[model samples]
Target chain A: MANTTESNLPGDDVLEEPVPAMQQLLDNPFLLLFIGIAVPTVLYTIWGVMEIVNLPIAK
Target chain B: MAVNRNFRTCPTTGLVFHEPAEKLMRWNAVVAVVALLVGGVLAIGVLLTRWQAVHLLQADLFYQFLTAHGLNMLVFWIIFFEMAILYFASSTLLRCRLATPALAWAGFWLMVVGALLNNYAVLRGDSSVMFTSYAPMGAHPTFYAGLILFAVGALIACFVFFGTLVVAKAERTYHGSVPLVTFGAITAAIIAVFTIATGAIILIPTLLWSLGLIEHIDSLMYRTIWWGFGHSSQQINVAAHVSVWYAGAAVVFGAKPMSEKVSRTAFLLYIFFLQLASAHHLLADPGLTSNWKIFNTSYAMYLAVLASMVHGLTVPGSIEVAQRLKGYNNGLFEWLRRAPWGNAPFVAVFISIVGFGFLGGISGVMMGTEQLNLIIHNTLYVPGHFHATVVIGTTLAFMGLTYFLIPVLFRRKVAFGNMATWQAYIFGISMSGFSVFMMGAGTLGAPRRHWDISFAGNPFGYEFPATAWLMIALMGIFGVGALVGGAMYLAITVYSVFLGEKIQTPDFATVSAKRGMAPAPQPVAVGATGHGAGVGAWGMVAPGTFVLALVFLTSFVLYYFVNWKYLSTVWPLK
Candidate 1:
């Protein structure tokens, strides 16, 4: 049943082709998730300090 | 042929994850968590400062943090996450590639850069006008620019979602009707498009005015049109989160709506009527006529509330029917009692339904009343009411969905198992208390957005009875607990995604992939004439949920009348 469904997919021939191992690693869900989380955390921490310096006294 | 190559089948769930779409979802979800972290830290500062005794930050810094907190949590965190959900529903559920993966990446980066720019403007200390940013009290031009970029990005994302739906239909991804979850996502995307358009219409001019391109922006015009963006943005959250509720029920319990036609009609009702609730904000303004306010707040808005009530009943009713079929059929709540309490997703859904209906729903109707609006217009009660809706209702449901995504999408075992189990309860209960205490203090005449509730050193100071101070203190304590809970969620998710044990399949002890993203199973026919199953009948299937609904209605009625009675005392008959 699963194989039949796969064969019936709209572009089965293109989907079945294998990809380079490096692209596969770069596309790993965990790796992407990590970059997503880490970049913001680090940037925001620096931004927080920048905010404090820019606005030393509130109007 | 290209379509087949770009998508991979999840072995456990059998859902197709298009490579580019999957990457986009991961990035959006990650950015959302980071936004939540920034907002959470600021939340603790604001909460402490509001508690008269602690009064943590100075007046200027308090307002700055308050402005940052509102935008980051309400706009940045939720919209980014909803964008991720949009991609998941369209591409993954329909088993098709995203319509424009490159455009989707552009949207993501625009939103990130825009959010950071907005934060930078607020942090500079000049834009302490709070989230409303009403006219004549102008901020730097960059604030408006950041918001415009964010709105445009969100608008593009919504179009991408709509395009994906078209692709699904063109390719015949499903046989007949799209799944209920996908339909719900469509409702969210439609509302988001309207919301972003309104935002752009008002904000673009506001940006020009700030840069001295225009003179004399009217405060009333700004308030009236801005709510069309501000409050309606929340309506988008309501649609998206309630969809999450239905999706969570389907995923966790294998549940289907008790009446699919009724549920779909309710979502349609949302499209027409939900935005009208924005009038509640303008009710107190002298510029709007009483007749217009009355029509908007009462007739049109009640229909929107009715849609919510319909959802409130059917979501749980569906869960009850599913449990009954599984033979948890002892009494009024055995089905509920025997539910998967240990599971984070189910816990979030159940708590969200209860909190949104009881706290958010009731208070909303009360505040929307013309006379009642005067009582709590800019009081702490307003924020209290929305915390119930946005935080408990939408944010918690999103958090629950994250637990499922961690293992399924990221392919890692959940870290800090005990903390993950307690995260929802700690956050939900403390937030529930926070809402109650904030409202209580507002009832005692505490002003919202005042740096010092005590009004220290003022020539004309009015003391708000000692109890208001106590309630504010309690709000601070509960807020701290909620912050801890939010931190736990962030910690657990971050550690798990980065460092936890890797898994090849979705069927780990922490995450179940039994049904996955497949369409919900059809409910069993209960009263078939040929079989002995006819003995049980339709009435027996969801009795527990019916009883719960009755209890909810009774509480709502009592609360409504109590507010009226309180109003009568405030202005006795002449």
Candidate 2:
């Protein structure tokens, strides 16, 4: 994995640079997008499965 | 000198191709095309016979042609092309020599021989059981043996692909991560390994049963495990073709994924959740528990659907962003309208994206739903759904890629260029119609795999509505249109590869470029600083695609509700 650690070059005054929250989200939009799509889909699917489970099978 | 001896740089794409691996890839692709031709011919017969007006073949011949068509198209043609793709993704894309070239050749021949043997069995009138050779309806032993050999060969090719990846890593051929397209191929190859192994476990026993070494294979068990092989094979195509879609974006527009990490995660979701879709096949089987069916079809399956949705959004999203960066940011659809529409690869991939999503993706989810499956299970709708996916989605993508390969790999100018440009639209639109009409007929309860949908001469003859006949006739007409498009493709590719004028240098982009269109977009250096540096980084450049995604979601929701409504009508509550 590529990581962004503080460099020891000429401008080594800062210890660690914090990545902005918005930039972090921007960098990984698919993650948020996937979660958003997946959560509702998972919930709906679970509801569907429960409905099937609760149904009466013909004798 | 070292590089020139073993590798040649494609002047067009600037990708290095290891010499021996190039030969293997070419051979596999050529044979895949041959298989497609055979399958395409058989498709006409089957379609004509099913049309009712033509009623082209006798019952036995219909079954035979159907069996050959299904196996040749679904198995031999697609897998052979994918073997070539695996080699290209690993050895070519990674700039490494293919590991064990001799073993790769052996694997290729094994696949060829197995394909021939299976074809011979079908042609001999002994194995007309169709692609899913369910037990108790025994095919000749050679049929099972041929399939086994083919599976083993494919397994070897998968290993060779993995080995090439290892070599690439060891040789430091590529820096940073492997390309996203290569990553997607790896996902497909992994799923293929599992699919082939399950295929072997089931098929070897079936072969023995055919040879009288074993007695009484369980019918339910056969159906149970066979789908692990059957449906999972299509899963392999899904992963591979999605990889092609990404590759096409990169090749044509030099587009990068919105987020490589996110895209890769979606692929991982495929590996985990996609195979469970095999359960949808057995949903109506009495022996299986509803819990098993419901869990696999609903819960786990939706994760797989989500993965596809992620891809569906990002692929076009990447293209939209790339186009916006190139000053096509006028309106919501300016980026889209300004796209190189006449470009074969662009048209093919774009059509594949839309058709797969609307026809294949939506119908698939609807059919996989338990109650909805009750409505369309074992009907022609099943084939309708897959035709959209496997044919429109995968085959069309492969066809698009072949245009690029002709000059870069085969070193010949694409012949009949105008035909190639129009071929994607003709084939795509016709197949889209075929799927829609077939599904419509299936909804009216058209029996799949029957010699006659009319139920002619049965002891208990039943009449279908007039609309069912109309839909089926339209399906047949559209099928012929698709066949014409297919023929044009074959003629263009065959002439280009074998007989067209040789070129010292070919401009790859010109194969798809139209006169008076804007010049081909310069390849952009992705992942550079400031590429995604601003407030607009949240895919604001791809607002068109974002709206398209919303439309897709709306379509999915409405379709889901409508299916449930249809299901409610099927079995009314007291």
Candidate 3:
């Protein structure tokens, strides 16, 4: 998909040149994926453990 | 090889807008600036008191400061800004003149007078009962008087909006649909009616209490009703924030959501379901029954959360579509590449959304939960979460919008363009850093209002969390960022008004163009254009979004209906 505007990219009409660093990061979606899942998992896991600790054992 | 010009730009202004509508928007920005300054001062004072580790005044005075700060910043500043922005966006997009300019000015004065009286009461030591004026914490007679006056002023503003709607309707300017931004605002205004009404309900009695006519008001009752006002007022903020996002995306980058209809529906959901969402605030507070809390806080919040989730997905979904269309298609990275990252409004909106979604959403959900809220309720975490979302998210977007809005509104040359970019970065980074630190301190169990952490007789002689202190001190750096950024913005605005280059703007172009006429474009973007493009697109679904806003509306209605069917015989309301 192209930008809705008819005007060309001003001055520098550089098309589809991949920036190395961004490309590298994009290649590994797992990094963001890991952080996303790991973070909430840790937090919620802590919450679950706390709940378990606070639970009363039936006699 | 070439596309038929889907959009046109005027050679004179280098953009598109109607003249009168632009003028009205400019006036709105001017008033907003005044409101922001007043609110900012109160906020700065509060922040200083928190940061300096010294009580500037006694506890009572401090309470007054806190009260004044909340009223000034939260109610006066944000609402006034929203009103101005809302009017500009709605009227411009609809292509109509303000139904009554006199009514708008009247609304502005009413709010100004109300704010002035409220502040004056606080200064006089007449009404420092804090913003909520929770019954027995009774304010001075003057304080209640000011509140009533302010509420009245806001009501008048609402009426002025109706006037705009009437004008738009009668003139056939809107072409059978309200713009998305205006539609969201209508919902916001609808919620505001509830918010202000609840505010009036609480303030009138509190005012009576201050007058000595009423012996005493119950704190519990006052708080319950007060939250009705307090909670919903924030919904107005939430709606405004969403509206700003839409506007900012469109203006800054020429981005439009894939489906205006879906986005508009999300906003309407807020109107129907926002009042019930307030229960989340009281989840941890005592006095409310567990059952009441569950229904109002937990169950009620489910719909609100769903609403947020829908938006959480949909807004970005729209952006993703926009980016895709822009030909960023290097897979996922292609979208990122194609986004208008260079635009200040674009960057600010993105950063705010990301930060609010993560930090604000995290703490908000945790605090609203029945079980998790117990640990962090009333802690510094509460403030941290709110500031992250409301301040960084909403306030930053407003600032970003203003960059374009001020130039167009006032028809003045922006004093320092490059400096504005740096200012945005500094402001965004610092606020985010500060919020994270504050939230961390909260988790460590640091109390919010203790001037010092010193402990005289505790069994554990350690005064407070050392890490908390360090984090808070670190937050001062961000405070500097906020101050400097604010100063830069102020300087540009002032310079533009007095000394910047002047340009000839067309007469009545804003309203006339909105009415779909081939009108002369003015120097700057009007309310519903440029920074508010997404909002304009969203306007098409104004009437319907309220009916089907998915964010909180669905869960809210479902919760209400379900509970009504099952427990109506036993519940308190019945």
Candidate 4:
């Protein structure tokens, strides 16, 4: 691999620069994981369960 | 290299592989192909019986083997290979050691055992309840147990993948971002975690019911929960295979994604909305509210479809741009024409992108539509749609990646030099034909999962249209060809793994350095503070790809309404 340390030398402010807001959210695997799990759970599983439970008794 | 710290650097691609992770990947892939071998054998019986002239298997054997075929191909084979992809994407792509290699091996063994037990349960004759072991029709407890074990193992593996990513970051493996391919793999792993959890949610209780510990389980509940596992399993495949498409482009043409932001957002859309496509199976089912149905099938599903469309365009678009940069920019399709037609990995992935987009994507959108689904919900068309998506989309892409992996990871030259390329085209073409004919037979009312569509020996005979019969026969013929193609893939893969000559360093270049280099993104704007923003296209880089996407959109629009037109021909609603 090319010398990454050369680019990451002490004076380079690139390491300290702020990650863009969208990049921050997208790059965090845990946050994305939470969103991925929670959204699907709410939209599909929980909502489907609610609909199923509310069904009137078939006479 | 020692066992604990062993890492091998590929001279060609310059990617480093952790030894344990590589071993795990190799074993997982080998197991996946073994599962494919089992599934392919069952496919022959299934196809022959459907052919009607041969009608090889009896009804009992047919259902049993069909169950095995579905489980092996859909669940076992696909998941095992995905586990391999996860390891590679995380540990190899990110240039880090695999975290907790022992835990990964445990997961692998559990998966292997679970697959064996599941197949055993299905083939035992008593547990022939088919892939959707719907409630009120109980199988042996072991069938549910095996699947649960498999899902648990898969969940464990997903965590291992996530852990590897964490290790990579802490270790500072790559500079700016993990490559786009790794991001896509993470998307797949996230979906996988959700899928396995859904499987456990439904299957555990069903296992109890099968053991007679519970009195009853609701059929409706069973179905709703199962499709969450069932169809969302395909969602994982979508994410994984799409990653392969991106990686294939990079490997074959040194292509970079046009915009990392656009591609990543498309993956983000999948995370939020893709599982709602589980509702595609439920659109025809009773008791589900129309409002609920419409929301899932319409708005939510469209977002997911949009995500797939974006990927479908960008993978090829990126390829076209790379080719154009290589100076093939005469006309719109000159870039495509000048592509490496005889290369196995290139041919396979290109066919996958086109076939999946044209055949699978359009059909999927139509099926997911609430009204259009009514026409072909539980028919041969259902399998036809998935064969395009799952077989052509996922399986073929995986095969392409395998050709690349054989030389790089396995360090073996591909065994069937020219023959492997033929295998890819043959598989792509035959399977495309099979899917179309199957859907045609389905339009004329051929039921899926029926051992005999002819309705032989029934007192009240129900004969389908003659064209349906021809359609089915043609489907069978094409299906047979696909199976032969599948066999060729197996032979080529197995021979290469065990017997093909070893490759010395630099013998095969996965990503050629000097040739096919993607040009740097051009400046989109100049900031006030001397900072400049760059983007993929300085001007128009991929006009050919734009035309192709327009073609796709046109076909999709036509197909969407054609289904609506077909639905209108049904008995008019009052």
Candidate 5:
């Protein structure tokens, strides 16, 4: 078993830095929510891959 | 950067260093690359075969490629990537170093070796029984070899996780109890041990049989035990998804979930009930007793679902509290309205959970029912159900988390903005469309894995789900969009790490607690400094060497043992 140690590094108690304009735009919380929604949607669509790949293409 | 003094020095080592988060992010990126390479190969292979367009490869090669895709992309890549994420949750988030770095390396190497052996064995025309590897359809001896190696590696990784957590606890890195996200990861690691143990039990004996050391392993026994591993491993994915949610919420809301104690306890619940719930997968199978299936699928499975439900209720509940605290009180709906819409991680978390709930959860329940299972058993519907839960729910969450990792962990900048954002949406939307289309088509009765769906007259008669084939093709249009999105993501990430602008922010920041809401300020650079001696050399050590060593060990030891079996032993076959 490994041991845990408290960090004495700087910024332990400092307030979190402000999000820059670029980051503000980059942080899309809904995207996370969307991923949750997408899981079942994609899984249900597993057959799509089969259809396209399984088709009797002339080539 | 050298001129800019862009890199910070570690207090412990007095050497200029990359951020711990950056190191972890690099690890994740590499892992993602591996996953995509293997997964893409497998996906393409399946496409060709399903379309009956295997230009040159024979049946054996086709099956071999299929086996590789399933094992490599699905099991190997996902698990390894998950381990990297788990490590981040445990150490980086907590502001601590890994407890036993050596053990982590061991775990990583083991996994790599296992992956190599499995892939090589498959390519050699040895393994083709499908990822479940149903018994009696045994592959070349190397197939078992690869499987065993991989299982062992996974086991090692689990232990490394335990070691990391232990070190953190001992160091007083956390205040009272572990954070909810880390707690979830720990629970997942514990389950992984049991899952891998089951996998090894079945695969080892099969290996022996393949090498002619034993007459044969009971096919039924192998099936029973393998599923114990197979199904349970998926629960581990579930555990990881939940962890991502907590972490994602923290990033976006500056809000911790309500009742940290309850959330942590919920994670522990997963460890207890998760692995035992594998019976849910066997409900439709013929050999299991009806009572056994009923108890396992209905009752046992409920406990696991209940664990998830607790989190489901709690996480959103906490998010609600957080938003209120952030002062988004136009009304209850106002909090949701005010929530950050642009935070990538937050969106990923929300979307991932929703996917799991409506699509994954609904399908899971449907599949768990004894009677309902008869309908979806081998159809395109089954795959649809899993992709909903696993790919969209779990994999997508991990991807969102990667955005944070790039700047926070690796200290590297992201390549492009609109491109990354668009890629994420494209992938998510296409995949969602694909899954929904398949499930709907499945209800109409499209069989999964069929090479040709153009039957003369409906296979199921008027009850046939033939229209599903058309839906499936139409869905492919979305898949193309998804594939392009995936490519863009890779390109942007590569560009960010290697060529993106280099700017550093102080570690730790807060954003509004609402969903999809943009941060009020710029993203902060949250990083850590070691308390004791640190290894912060700007060493140019080759990471690929470790991967090579694993491959070498697997090939050398595996072939020697196999040759010994073939030469010295006689087959028990008639």
Candidate 6:
């Protein structure tokens, strides 16, 4: 109902349900939270141990 | 909610400010500024000592000040402010009561105590190990203890934020999805949890080592794990500041991101790839294979970089769309030209976006590149690049929000409007120059922490090019000027908060009425829009923004290859 000239888009006024998948992901903060925490724990932190554990002990 | 649940509606913005949450935010922000003051003082010593012209502090004291500066500015000041931002994003934006105000207060005090204790150790003439605190060069036990405590406190704050979100959801404080700004804060908090946990994992061992409980902390492992904390701290800033950008656009122009899904997808990329980009710190270190380095730096890092690039385009592009929608359609840049240039919040946010992109974004990509990072690693360029990102990008955006918060949150008319506008430009532009000049010196071979650029006392001293000295001198001047701008900002904020005229019986519409203008001219904020259904001369929603982005890309391409050319020239090929 804004007459401020910016709410002119076709879909700006009323958002359609069944939001797009990426948006659905954004909408679910918990899922994003799970993925955000999990991905790094796997690839960066746990995998990081693999990087150094295999190195030959310094003489 | 155990804490006070009183809510006061902001007359300016109409968002209800939870009383306890507002108090928490004000205190954290106040403490953050105090930390900035301490760090800024140390920066003067740092700037003078490293300038080669001044050489103010001796080597030991220089390192001490630098250590304190790094911790206070990068860790304490930033994270403390971020805690406040999280509260604002959740309890404030969602119009909900804070979940656990008691826990938040406990976290705040713990953070404060830890900060004071760390400064105590550093200034007591022992923990001059610098920000990295790499193994073998041990600091005082208190230093490690303080950092551990602070990390724990920040972790608690992050959880409180999450809990508040749950409270909002359970209570149905907001309809449909959380707003984009709140979502951005969620990203930041998620990243903060990761950063702080990573810090705890490493710093706890470091604390044990400092206390002589452990025989040795492997320097390699320590460096690797520390960067997971150190570098990802910047990732938190990236998320937070990008949110500030979106929030600013919404408040100022009623602008939404051109595509909310695209922006959120970009954040998803950050979650997946950003921390891995921390491997750039380990690139030059021995024992890491070329394969890991190449994959992490070139491939994974670029994806993270892509996320930032997506934000860079959308933030301004959305603003352009909003302006065009308001009928600023005379030319490609009339919208930009006729933007709310006089408003402090608008100027600060706009300048932050452009400076972060052109200065911070482009340079960051070049420095993150596997091959090119070697050229600038361990040089002044590291600090210079971060100055752009953290100071220009993050701090400026925070300042912009502060300007906005003054009128709305504090319920005071911001004092010295004209001076505030100039303060934005002064701080942004001067800091940009200071960073670039430091990078110029770094490119000419200035070492990172060395007190003297000339290496006057060393017997086997190698002389840098003449241009290096010039670069250092220029940076010093610009750095000092930037400090003055920072001082101005502090003065303005302090005065406005305490002494500015109060708004009683607040009618937000009265300002436009007083100005005798049509209501349409005033930027009455609607929520961020996702759909763009119009056309411009360039057959796009935001042609002017596209032009600006093309300029950014062109600069990035040119600078990137130029670094490559510089590297090729210096390569010791057989």
Highest DockQ against the true fold, candidate: 4
Q: Write the per-residue lDDT of candidate 6 for residues B286-365, one digit (tens) a residue.
A: 87777777777788889988998899999988888888778786678988998998888888888788888888888888
Which wins on lDDT, candidate 2 or candidate 3?
2
Clash pairs, model 4 backbone: none
Fraction of reference contacts reproduced per prediction? 0.00, 0.00, 0.00, 0.45, 0.00, 0.35
Superposing every Cα of model 3 onto the true structure, what RMSD results?
14.6
lDDT of 4 by residue, B149-244 (tens): 899889999999999988877656666677899999999999999999999999999999988888889999889888999999999999999999
Would you list the clashing residue pairs of candidate 1? Answer: A14-B1, A15-B4, A15-B5
Across A1-59, the per-residue lDDT of candidate 6 in tens digits comes to 11122223234468667766766777777787788878777777677667887899979
Once fitted onto the true fold, the runs of candidate 2 whose alpha carbons sit more than 4 angstroms away are: A1-59, B1-5, B506-539
Q: lDDT by residue for model 1 over B1-574, one digit each (tens)?
A: 2333255566555567767888889999999999999998999889889987889999999999999999999999999999999999988888766887778888988999899999999989999888999888899888999999999889889888877877766655654456777767877776677677768877999999998898877676677668777987898889888989998887777777877778877876676677777778977886566665776678778888999999999899888777766777677888789999988888988889999999999899989889988878888999999999999999999999998888778878888876776998999898999998998888778999789988889999998899888888899888888898899899999999999888765432222112222222234343112211212234556777778889999999998898888887777665
TM-scores of the candidates, chain A only: 0.39, 0.43, 0.39, 0.72, 0.28, 0.60
Cα lDDT tens digits for candidate 2, A1-59:
11112222233455566866644543332343344334323432333345445657669
Estimate the TM-score of every prediction: 0.87, 0.87, 0.76, 0.93, 0.74, 0.93
- TM-score of chain B only, all predictions? 0.94, 0.95, 0.82, 0.93, 0.80, 0.95
**Residue runs of model 1 more than 4 Å from their true location after superposition:** A1-59, B1-5, B505-540
Clash number for candidate 1? 3
> Which stretches of candidate 5 lie above 4 Å from their native place?
A1-59, B1-25, B48-62, B454-463, B504-574
Per-residue CA lDDT of model 5 for B362-402, tens digit only, reads 67766677766665667777777777788778877877877
> Which candidate, 2 or 3, would have the higher DockQ against the true structure?
2
For model 5, what is the C-alpha lDDT against the true structure? 0.61
Docking class of 1: incorrect
Per-residue alpha-carbon lDDT of model 3 for B185-291, expressed as tens digits? 77666667667777887778777777788887766566666777787787778778878887776665455654665675565445445566566666765556566
